[model samples]
Target: MGDRNGCSTPGGGGSALSVMAGAVIGAAGLAWWLLSEAERRRQQPRQPRSLRLSTLRTPVPAEVGTGTSSEPHERDLHDRVHELNQAIDDVRRQLESMNTQA
Candidate 1:
């Protein structure tokens, strides 16, 4: 079968035209959406310099150390050191046991 305008294939011309039109419409829609989004972002309210400076000038509260001890920082450090010593002892015992077995 042949198409009008003396073409050999059927429906080829109409399909190609439809594809081109769809692509053009899709491109136009994407461009419009991007431009609108950019315009909206440009129109948004920016943070005032005075508000930003004030926030920067405010003093932050002192951070409290973790743990329930009276001297939290010293107690935390002591506990950590004790834990490390215990771990060292455990490793030494393991090494001794391995040497005896060998």
Candidate 2:
């Protein structure tokens, strides 16, 4: 019997084996290409770690309102907020004392 392409049956020739070998070679080539591409990417120099504003540890300004303090200290967000609140309270107290004296 003949196939759709009018090719004779597998018993007439080793067409089946040839097709299988071609498929195997194609698969191997694809795998090799993928591996080489991966290796090429691995060899390329990676981009340097980009600087992010969020990651930066900018020093907190000292004494909230005076605007005169130049010294800055590296403190985390929570601690810096606490310090600001304390400075605000201190200023309030100072204002009250001045008012009472007046």
Candidate 3:
């Protein structure tokens, strides 16, 4: 531990104090570097984005007749159309079942 220069040996009070001072300076340097890096990151310019427009069509009912018609008749027509579709589907399913059995 004694490198004879009349100075204190390694692991003595002076050496220990010197090592602690070195450690403190190192830590302070690391902290300053981190803060400067953060500042540099904040100063960087952001990229501008271009928004592309989408073309999508939505289906809406055509306005043909004005409101002079009976509401009950309109409802009856809608129900009849629905029932016809169901009947057609049932007939198709029965035909498919019969064909498979055959």
Candidate 4:
């Protein structure tokens, strides 16, 4: 038959242009994919070191209080302080008794 160029379909001349165009399109698609992957990595949230238990492992004393110091916190703090003082007195009496026995 004959192509639209009317050359009777000999070898081919425009085939190289088609190959180059396809290569350009493929390269552009690859570039876009790489950019999208990079953007996804950028948008990902990072893991906070402070949220880990090991990072917050401070040695707290046994008789220490752990109440919030906000305003509106009234009776709870007073009750805790009173209870802690009683416990401390009880321990002191026990230690004094042991010392007297020795």
- Predicted structure with the largest TM-score when compared to the true one: 1
Query: What does candidate 4 score on TM?
Result: 0.35
TM-score of every model versus the real structure? 0.38, 0.34, 0.35, 0.35
Candidate 3, run of 10 with poorest lDDT: 47-56
Question: Where is model 2 more than 4 Å wrong at Cα?
Answer: 1-13, 46-102
What would the per-residue lDDT of candidate 3 be over residues 1-102, giving only the tens digit for each residue? 356754566557787789999999999999999999998777654322111112123343455577544565799999999999999999999999999999
The residue pairs found clashing in candidate 4 are: none
* Tens digit of per-residue lDDT, candidate 1, span 1-102: 455555767577788889999999999999999999998777654446667788889875566676333476788899999999999999999999999999
Q: lDDT of candidate 3?
A: 0.75
lDDT of 4 by residue, 1-102 (tens): 469775755456577668999999999999999999998777654445444555579654343356544423567788889999999999999999999999
In order, the Cα lDDT scores of the candidates are 0.82, 0.74, 0.75, 0.75
What does each candidate score in C-alpha RMSD?
12.3, 19.1, 18.6, 22.4
- lDDT winner, 1 or 3: 1
After superposing candidate 3, which stretches have Cα over 4 Å from the reference? 1-11, 46-102
lDDT score, residue 50, model 4? 45
The candidate with the higher TM-score, 2 or 4, is 4
Order the candidates by lDDT, highest first — what do you get?
1, 4, 3, 2
Candidate 4 off by > 4 Å? 1-11, 46-102
